[model samples]
Target chain A: MSERTAAPAGQADGRTDDQADRRADRRAERRAERQAEEGERRADPRRRNNRAWLLVLPVVVSVAFTAVIPLMTVVNFSVQDIFSPGDRLFVGLEWFRSVSRDPEVRAAFVRTLLFSAQVLLLEIPLGVLLAVSMPRRGVWVSVTLVLVALPLLIPWNVVGTIWQIFARPDIGLGGWAVNNVLGLEFNYTLDATDAWITVLAMDVWHWTPLVALLAYAGLRSIPDPYFQAAQIDGASAWATFRHIQLPRLRGVLTIAILLRFMDSFMIYTEPFVVTGGGPGNATSFLSILLSKIAVGQFDLGPAGAFSLLYFLAVQIVCYVFFTVLTRTGR
Target chain B: MADIRLEGVGHSYDGGRTWALRPMTWTWRDGRAYALLGPSGCGKSTLLNIISGLLSPTVGRIWFGDREVTGVPTAGRDIAQVFQFPVLYEEMSVYDNLAFPLRNRRRPKAEVDRRVREVSRLLGLEEHLRRRSRRLDPGRQQLVSLGRGLVRADVAAVLLDEPLTVVDPAMKWTLRSELKQIHRDTGHTLIYVTHDQTEALTFAEEVVVLNDGAIVQAGEPSELFLSPAHEFVGHFIGSPGMNVLPAELLDGVVRVGDATLGRASVELPSGPVRVGVRPEFVRIGPAGAASGPVARVTGVDRMGAYNLVHAEVNGHPVIARTDAATTFDAGATRVLRFAEGRAFLFRDAVRCGALEPLDGRAGA
Candidate 1:
């Protein structure tokens, strides 16, 4: 087998073989040299200057244009005044003083704080209980979770509008049923206490599901081994929650609390539609007050200043919450 | 201290469509460490969960001491469990993690501190008390769970369910030994679950070998290793598994395809059966014997200390452990013979009481 094939291949050698072999060898040498050079290039780790930030430059610019620019404009307007359309005068802290002394602004601040606190206190525990009781699997779980999330998807204005008509004493189901069946006169438009309670109930109805959903996701994320370990440790149900479940859910719960607080603090649409911040400004939170100053009065100078201060207050609260919870590692 | 008894304990997952654990009875004495060993999905973890009151048996009763506590809740049962993954409060310090159970019971501060320190010393975690459990490595976090379970000695029992399955291989041996030492010192009725035979054999005094949700064998570790009652047990217990050869029964003699598989020296049943012999018992040498079965070498796998010689005998794969010093090229023909009385014969999958004297299904 070797002799027959070897004879033909050897016969074709001669001068062509010598020239072809040299050319092939040189090409091989050049290729090897190029590879070696490439290898050395890769080996020099310090030479690579990863310009990855360039990829996110567009995102940074977009955020600056849409968010940071407007925010800065508010800040600028807060410290200055336009005497007659475009003629500016710097008043410094005068607007802050005027807004702080205004009973309307003071009332809004207190109302916002009370609303946020009340929502947080009511929703957190209830949400956690609902989450713990919810089944972890099967078709029923999917259905229940989807249903719970339905209210969160409704637009704020629509939620307000729906509740407004539903709570009318003459025709609305809630007011009419309560008046007829319970024999009580509960009118949100005429009573401050009634308006406050109505607003709280609306906020609870609209947002409790969010906290429950987040808490449920947190519960589901806990590994089974933890429960097993707790069982072996002879821990009671409450102990398990305090020691294992609560700690594991801390990050999610913090986020939940912050989200609920921020949303409740800035709540305007629902109360505005339902009671128009009335029962005599009983539910006029800071957001509503800013809108009142800007749109109702059209005093852009003082209103812009008030809005900027409002933004700073919200930022400060969020920043403080973040720092305290995160730095202490709770 | 108490003895655990499971009488007629069995479970079905789909209302009897599939059984997760078959009818089984066993007794685990107080202060004795026991291991339920099996492969994954072999119902080892299920059994552990049942014993811990995390699962209820469809038909059975579990007793701790003289009391029938099968229907008791987990909180009332008093069994401490260490999970496969560490379940720690990430927000709490290791100190808090260890003290949580004691605090829940409203134990005195001094007693809590003493117990926590003792467990911390035992686990070498005293210095890490102030660190958050989440910041620790998975191994150390698991140790905290272990410490928590061990913190209360007055508890009924301690159950560990494959706790070392997630541990690093380098640390596995050390932790296994530590667990064994802890058991020895505490004298707790420990029921550990693991699929790995080595861990079960080394850590447990008696191993309950399970397969397909049934108790195939239960005895001392050596007994199960030396005399397995079922083909599954024999295959599951040993490191390399037993070599089973299909054979025909004729006039009380077992014939492997063509060649006779030595004498049982013990009685034999007349039927189609399998002859079982461990790879360690097989003798291999050059092909000039002119006796026993003639085998052609197929390949060799070099284990750390020995070579697993793979060979084909009459078209059947046979494995034998050859000495590290011996060398054989592929395709080389070699003669193989089993030790005189080591051959085990199985009818269907159950050990026939006739072969190898049965040995009472030792080495569980």
Candidate 2:
């Protein structure tokens, strides 16, 4: 049977280069024929273009109305100097340069970076510690989760208002306690250090729970086998945390850092309500500075330029953070 | 290596109301491979954890080479374990994962490097030592996990909880043989836990069969096959397993239905007894041949090398294993005979003794 089949195949290959080229042509023809047969076999009336975009058309329309239009307006304002409603002059890159060169804007940019750094440095470890110490199972798990998430549930402006009242030296409990119990003359209204500390504390109180909740989720996702294996491997508590827990929590911690960084860098409502960028502009972060330019001074060009720069800065940081996290994760 | 002894060990995830592992005592000798074989949720993992000190047995003491380690944490107790799923330090390289245990014990860098290289080479992970552990395939990751367990020299016993469960099917056999070779070479006191009978029977020197949180039988693979101490063991060990028939014991003879099958080696109590014989030992012949009890062939399953003949003898189902040469048609009458000396008699589900052929017509 093999010899009979091979005879024709051998005869077909008896010619040299010319025959080989003809055989190749035949092979290509066979392939094309096979593909056409397959295409015919797979042909179905249901294989029509459904145009699924119609389903999401409402969402797209709303997003264009809410986000795209406002962003376009900002971009438009950014490249032109708008003196009045209809009085505008196209002046590209001038506003961006002025905003970048302003000493106050530079100070606020630096302070924003330092503030985000401080928030991350303080909140990440504290949140992880809180998550680790929280009850892992049973009735108390829900209770602890709710309690930790309590601050995150508050509206940002409401948080600012609560802290505003809570930090008043004459009436509030915190300021009164610090003043009378510790005998340290503390007043956030007049002192730059006091204002910075109060703003930092308020930010920590409000956002640390977000980090804690994320870390808790990360901790919970780890299977019990890892811990059991670590225990059986004779790993100490610190070793287990360093090798097992921390490495496992890398993705979550990265997200938490990114979230806290962006949120803290663009913090506005709470500090604005509580400090009002007061105590000689001590707690004036980027958003507060941006608000003062856009609303207080009505400098749309510089504020628009600053907003774009801020958006780019956040994107760059997030990209770097995400890349570092995923690379290390692998 | 140290011998591990469990005295009256029992565990309860709940506080002593119900037991996951019933109170039992056993000893694992030094430098030997043992297998804990059971179905899922049979407390095999619970037992492995108790021995490894991951779980404190509620009512017992554990001793390692005469030192009581019942109160010691898992880290303090000298043991290593590989889990069902590979538990590698995902961020670490294969070399670091193998070195982790030794480094945690503060072993010198030189010693850690030497042992890591040695075990990695042993597990065929020498070329991939610098690669991140999580990037490897599941089989290689599991090998890395096994290497981590093997790298530590001071552990009393290495506990493996179905370590090959996640490995690919084609790789499982190779890994199992490699593990067997590793056991022979290292002389480590290894306790492997698996639900796979093939894995248990082939890998371990002694197999402890468990069912419903209690040990059914503990013996060598051949002994388990030949003389299963419990009916569960008889049913669980083999592919088709042993066929258990309800019978009556009167005088010295065992009667299944109306046929006098054989005589018990020991005088069994005059009551109900289950006669068990492996399918391989159940012989089938033409009916009315004056050879053995008669049965009707119900079905035949051609399983490649052998044919499994399912038959009914006086309303009781029986399975006889025959080679490809032997053929049986469904609904045909045949004579089924239990091979003498291979037939087991069980009283109240516990094995009593074997049955001897009454007349000398064993192979007829």
Candidate 3:
């Protein structure tokens, strides 16, 4: 048996050696062919320029018309004092100084900062809590999402109108509930405190849903494996939220904070509709003060200067915010 | 550490109408490594989740060292699990990721520090301790996850759900061996779930082979390979698996096609049967041998250490894992022989017993 096996084994070894040599030769030939093809392709310059810029031409043109031209017009207005339709004086920096020293403008600037701070402080945490509690899957998820997003879909002026009627002390359901059920004096048009509270409430109602929806999308993006891992790590619910969900939600929260800050800093329509900058200047934000100068008072020079400063403030705040967030994320 | 006992555990994602896992009872002995091996969607992960208390079985009680823990939440059960995809707190340093569980349990700062350092060293993550976990490569991230599971001294068991799936191919074997070594040093009741047979055979002392939401066989790796209790076990355990051929049992001998090749070692009713033999045991010889069936060679695959000769016997294809020194030309006729005492007969897809090869004159 050993002798017969040895004869066949020896013959097979010799045959395999020959076969392996031929296979190696074939592989080397294939490699050389591929390298030659790659070299030829590298020498072709036209292949490198795929003419991708044509796809972006529309966007460039649209942005120049919508953003750049308007920005230049604002810069042009900020340097001139126009007394009439065709009479204008280029009194550079004088209008800027007058607007900066106006007591009402400074007070409105401070009020705007306070309002944005309060909105971010109240809405971010509340939105995150709502997002965390929302159903992750099932029919209820779609239903809840659609219902939560209803406030954001309402027209801005319509939202102001809805709240104006809703906060009246006489007939509206909310006003009736507050005054009749709880017997509290609640007229947004009467007291400055009431007007401020009503405006804040309306803003939160309209925009907190946007934050919640963004947060919910962020929460949904986290895979189930992380939650499973957290459970197996013996983490408590709070611990899971702190260590897993919150870290994952950081990027979305930064965006939500910046968005809420900018929008609230430039708040005009809702407060103007609800309280007409109200019983006093209590609820008047920066945009309201700017509108008062530009349209109500028709002081275009000072208004343009204020608009530029407001734009600068928003840009600086967003830049600082983005930097702080990205630095801590690392 | 504690032994985990499942008493008639069953789960149905659709509320008792259809089950993801059929009701079954099994015990994992304390301080031993066990593997739950199966193909994808075979309830291995479901079983792992039930054991870890992340899931509650629809109809059974789970016990850990004689205490019923079916009602316990995952945190209350004192078990750790590593997921298939590495799940690290990306915002944290490797040290912080490893220390999270210990810190959550409110362990003392000194003990937490000591264990964190010790586990980091064990996983070779000491140098990357201060680096953010998400910045590390996937293999290192998985190591940090494993280190977190090992950081707690009081953990009863560590469940791994294909923890090396995301790891690079070259690092898989190294990480697997390291995991086995860690199991030895830590003595935790480890339950590893995977679809890879090589991983199961090498990592676990005992392997439970599951199929279609049921365990077909559970035994030592060698026992499973040598004497499979079910046909699925024979088919699923080996590379190229076992060759199952149609055969007949007449009187006391087993006949394939027209040739009587062997006798059954155990009593089998005289009727149709399936003969299963590993590829390694099937030998090929020159055509027109005194005994054995004639097969037509189809192909020969040159695998570095061995050549797989593909042939057809009685119209059924069979593969023989032969040494490179055995050669046969395609389309040539050859005689195939089954090694004595290595063949098995199956009745109704369940293994009946072994088969003993007969001498050439037995049929005559």
- In model 3, the Cα lDDT at residue B108 comes to 96
DockQ, per model, reads 0.39, 0.59, 0.56
Question: RMSD per prediction, one decimal?
Answer: 14.9, 6.8, 11.8
Clash list (residue pairs), candidate 2: none
Shift in Å, residue B334, candidate 3: 2.1
Candidate 3, clashing residue pairs? none
Sort the candidates on TM-score, descending order. Answer: 3, 2, 1
Q: How far is candidate 1 from the true structure (C-alpha RMSD, Å)?
A: 14.9
lDDT digits (tens) for residues B214-295 of candidate 2: 8989999999998889999999999898898888889878888777788888976787788999998998877877656689
Q: Is candidate 1 or candidate 3 better by TM-score?
A: 3
Tens-place lDDT per residue, model 1, B206-295, is 898899999888989988877788889889988688888777777666666655554444466567888787888778866856355678
**Tens-digit lDDT string for candidate 3 (B3-108):** 8899999999999998889999999999999998999998999999999888899999999998999999998999989999999999899999999999888999
The window of 10 residues in a row where model 1 chain A has the poorest summed lDDT is: A226-235
Candidate 1's error at A247, in angstroms? Answer: 1.9
For residue A50, model 2's alpha carbon misses the true position, in angstroms, by 16
Residue runs of model 3 more than 4 Å from their true location after superposition: A1-61, B359-364
Candidate 2 deviant stretches above 4 angstroms: A1-63, A328-330, B359-364
Chain B only, TM-score of each candidate: 0.92, 0.96, 0.95
Q: Identify the runs in model 1 with alpha carbons over 4 angstroms from their true place.
A: A1-56, A72-97, A138-140, A177-184, B102-114, B129-131, B264-269, B285-290, B353-364
Report the candidate with higher lDDT, 1 versus 2: 2
